[model samples]
Target: MDSSENYRVVCERVAAAARHAGHEVTLLAVGKTQPASALRQLAALGQRAFGENYVQEALAKQRELAGLGLEWHMIGPLQSNKAREVAARFHWLQSLDRTKLVAALDRHRPADAVPLQVLIQVNIDDEASKSGCRPADIGALAEAVRAAPRLTLRGLMTIPAPHPDPRRREAAFARMRVLFDDLRRAHAGVDTLSMGMSDDFEAAIAHGATLVRLGSALFGPRR
Candidate 1:
């Protein structure tokens, strides 16, 4: 199918999932290795949010699509060196895993811009290679984010270990939902729970994911 057809199918699936889950969910097109033109195409189809893994690539796309009013999310592991660019350019950071990054992002955020929307990525499955904080560390990291003048604590994000069993994945999502609920109770304005991707979004939504990221399912496989 073409991009528009792919978009329609994905939207229909998302709407069906949302209806089943009894809540509204947001879709973030994962534009990682895709071209800026692809993003323009999706934007023309009413996709307003896009997620990118690299700062430079997202910056270029942002420049190319300058006036579209699209929301850019940094959905990959972030380094301290690139915090300034991310703080100044991206609308949201979905991989905040440490206290150090909190300070860097807070310090570099432009005073004129709105507070950067932030999600605490939790390593729910405790994978050694993941880019999120330990589930035990959520509170401290959340406190750091809240104390930062230029960041907003928007709730949790997780990429669970891709277990072969669907039930196992749903279990991880359920755990994340508990963490998200606890976060909302402790922090005012904590509403986003970004924990789904193309393959398992329906499951994620069933467990309370307010935002799901889609790439191949929306734009076909990356070249």
Candidate 2:
């Protein structure tokens, strides 16, 4: 399908999933590796929420797609030096997995904007390559986040080891739910479990995910 048609189909599916999940599903068009023209087309399709893996790529889209008012999310691994730039631009940081990073985020938030929306990336599979905090450490980090002036401890996010099986994905999502609950008990106003992706997002929703980061499911497989 052409980009506009493809974007329409994806947006419809995403809205349906959101309603079905009883979640305020935020359709973060995972625009990684996608061209600015395609993204501009998609953005024209009433898509305001977008996620990009690389900081430079996101900035390019942000600049290219100017006046579209997209809410950009940094969904990939972030290094220390880039944190300041990211804090200055992106609306959401969905890949935060460590205390030091969290501290850096707090220190760097631009003073004028709303408290930045942040998510704690969880490495549910305990994989060395993936970015996320181990599930057990979230509570303490949430507390630390609460104290950060520039950040609003909005919720948790994760990239579990991918499993096509619905039940297994749900279990991983359920673990996220447990951690979410733990955070709420400790820090009030901590909501949103930003789990799930194209392959297993339905399972994540069934288990409780407020936001789903989708790429291929919406845009089709990236070549």
What is each predicted model's overall lDDT from 0 to 1? 0.95, 0.82
Q: What are the per-residue Cα lDDT tens digits for candidate 2 across 138-220?
A: 87777777789889888888888766666776788888898888887877787778887888777777777888888886667
What range of 10 consecutive residues in model 2 has the weakest lDDT sum? 161-170
Would you give me the overall lDDT of model 1? 0.95
lDDT of 1 by residue, 1-223 (tens): 9999999999999999999999999999999899999999999999999999999999999999999999999999998899999999999999999999998899899999999999999999999998899989999999999999999999999999999899999999999999999999999999999988899999999999999999999989996
State each candidate's clash count: 0, 0
- Off by more than 4 A, model 1: none
RMSD vs true structure, all candidates: 0.7, 1.6
Q: Which segments of model 2 are wrong by more than 4 Å?
A: none
